[model samples]
Target: MTAETDLIKLYSQRILALAADMPLAERLEAPMASVKKRAPLCGSTVTVDLDVEDGRISRFGQDVKACALGQASAALMGQNILGRTQAEVEAARDALKAMLKDGGPPPGAPFAGYDVLEPARDYKNRHASIMLALEATSQAMAEAQQADCA
Candidate 1:
């Protein structure tokens, strides 16, 4: 069917592979910070847990419930989230948003794996799901940092 073909085109083999083997798929035994993000439109959700050290992510994990696009996005974010600062994660999140909504460039390095999602630009509805992991990660990092300050 046309719709199926279109989906296959959008969710390519690479995307499926990333989704199938998401990094940091397990939860951290003890997280310094945690955040959950849900895509209201699709009901997809990602729960992120992490610990920060020296202003960078020291450990990371996630529970992802979403379509292939969301899973792939989470996989990419999880793969590289460790060692990243909240500012870096937020920058990647912003870049991804621009890429999806404004036809901008892919996110910078460390999160460059997000480039694989370029095809998803046409599917505006899926944007939130794809960005959920980064959103949760950024928030968790900020929370951890704030707690450290407090």
Candidate 2:
């Protein structure tokens, strides 16, 4: 395939549209937990704010500063974040990492949409940025869990 095709494949219209429509694009005023992650290779940063209750996400928000790929990943996470448990978030994170780093398949429902990011596997440098939302969410969940137990 041509270089143009590669670019087009990586930056498809669906990905771009998801990036444009960032759900939960605001920070929560009193988040139960918050975390920020940065992709050094691309200087992409994402900060997530969340509230958890009864072992599930009750509220969520994010501040995304990255390319279309990162934004799209965040969009997918935001779309599926509500009511998710720590186990679900961690499962998605692990599955996404395995998919990108070890050629594994995407996670099941609630996170299967991340299959769109399959193209990102070919670009190692973009992996960190693409995984930012998941990383931040996982960290935030941990923090919330700790506070809940405290």
Candidate 3:
């Protein structure tokens, strides 16, 4: 197979593997905060839910229906965000956006885990899918924090 084809296959397989490992129940639970993002060009949508207490995430979930990249991104977000604090999640979100937009460096230790998505940087269209969950999570956390203060 050509190198390009192989890369596509590899990324696709990785996404599938991540998706397969996600538990449905974890993605369906009610969230203290929720946000939705859609990639209109691809008709990909991701809805992320979060429950936070004392600045730490107490619960996390999402309902996603989209391409492999979107699904995999959601799954990865679910796996990694379970115990992280609001500040940590925000850092990761910023890092993820920078990475996708300019291939900029990651946002330090709290967001280093986002490196798993580095392989996706070269895949342009996949960028939107990958960012969907991150954006939703960040927005949800922000709104949740605001509500807590009100």
Top-lDDT candidate index: 2
Taking the tens digit of each residue's C-alpha lDDT, what string does model 3 give over 1-150?
Answer: 788885876476666787667533245465678888898778798877787788877777778887766777677677777777777777777777788788987556644445556777777777887788878888888887787788
Q: How do all the candidates rank in terms of TM-score, highest first?
A: 2, 1, 3
The lDDT-based order of candidates, best leading, equals 2, 1, 3
In model 1, the runs with Cα more than 4 Å from the true position are: 1-4
Off by over 4 Å in 2: none
lDDT for model 1? 0.92
The reply for model 3, stretches above 4 Å from the true place, is: 1-12, 23-30, 105-116
**Stretch of 10 with least lDDT, candidate 1:** 1-10
TM-score computed on alpha carbons, candidate 3: 0.80
Lowest summed lDDT over 10 consecutive residues: which window, candidate 3? 22-31
Task: Please write out the lDDT profile of model 2 over residues 1-150, one tens digit for every residue.
Answer: 887888899999999999999999999998999999999999999999999999999999999999999999999989889999999999999999999999999878987688888988988999999999999999999999899899
